[model samples]
Target: MNHLKVLALSAGALTLVPGLALAHGSMRPSHGGVVQMSGEIMVELVTKPKALEIYVTEEDEPIPAADFDGTLIVTAPGGAKTRSALKAVSGNKFVSSGRPGSGSKVVVSLIEKKSSAKTFASFTMK
Candidate 1:
């Protein structure tokens, strides 16, 4: 009877392991920037003086650079809008040539090259 009880306890513990693994995701900014999730992917935006860099990943796995076309739209506080085309630089990172200023509204869109499926994330610059 004790052996059967121990086996039951072990099976219950094993069930929790996979559930914990599925909860894994990184909200800690890897690049010292803002991080947000669009569906299952994490989008990290790093703003520089002259450019904007977006890093995309799914559960910490790098999404292929050649798989998508991306764009960034920046809307200023005064309602001016600027759009930049992002090109993949390296390792799941897409970069465009404009600095969306502080408090500005920014929208990022990535369209899959093969399926044309779209994914979007919106952020307000800080």
Candidate 2:
């Protein structure tokens, strides 16, 4: 019957809505920082007075920081740019020593060691 087909179609469509909503996963920062999505990976930028920490995750699960080589690029409000290498401290944490001034734009680039694939995440220091 037409009514039965319509009901089934509506139910199927409703099911897909939830999947679409979850496709992007959570954007909330778990490490008290700003979060950005790079393809399927999530990058979190945590800024400290003396250091900057980067966290990488996929589907909320951490991907080992040691698996990639990374760089931290910071651009000041006056257009001055500084680059520093990020070292893997432990687990999913990549860190660099430096404080980006307020209003500075910070970008972290991670290159997978095995595949040479790059993932980038950017943030504005506040």
- Give residue 35's lDDT in candidate 1 (0 to 100): 86
Tens digit of lDDT per residue, candidate 1, span 84-115? 78989988988887777889999998999999
My TM-score estimates for the predictions, one after another, are 0.79, 0.82
The TM-score of predicted model 1 comes to 0.79
Q: Model 2 segments beyond 4 Å from truth?
A: 1-20
User: How accurate locally is residue 94 in candidate 1, as Cα lDDT from 0 to 100?
Assistant: 89
lDDT of each: 0.86, 0.90
Shift of residue 32 alpha carbon in model 2, Å: 1.0
* Deviation from native of the Cα of residue 51 in model 2, angstroms: 0.9
- Write the residue-wise lDDT of candidate 2 on 34-73 in tens digits: 8999999999999877998889999888999999999999
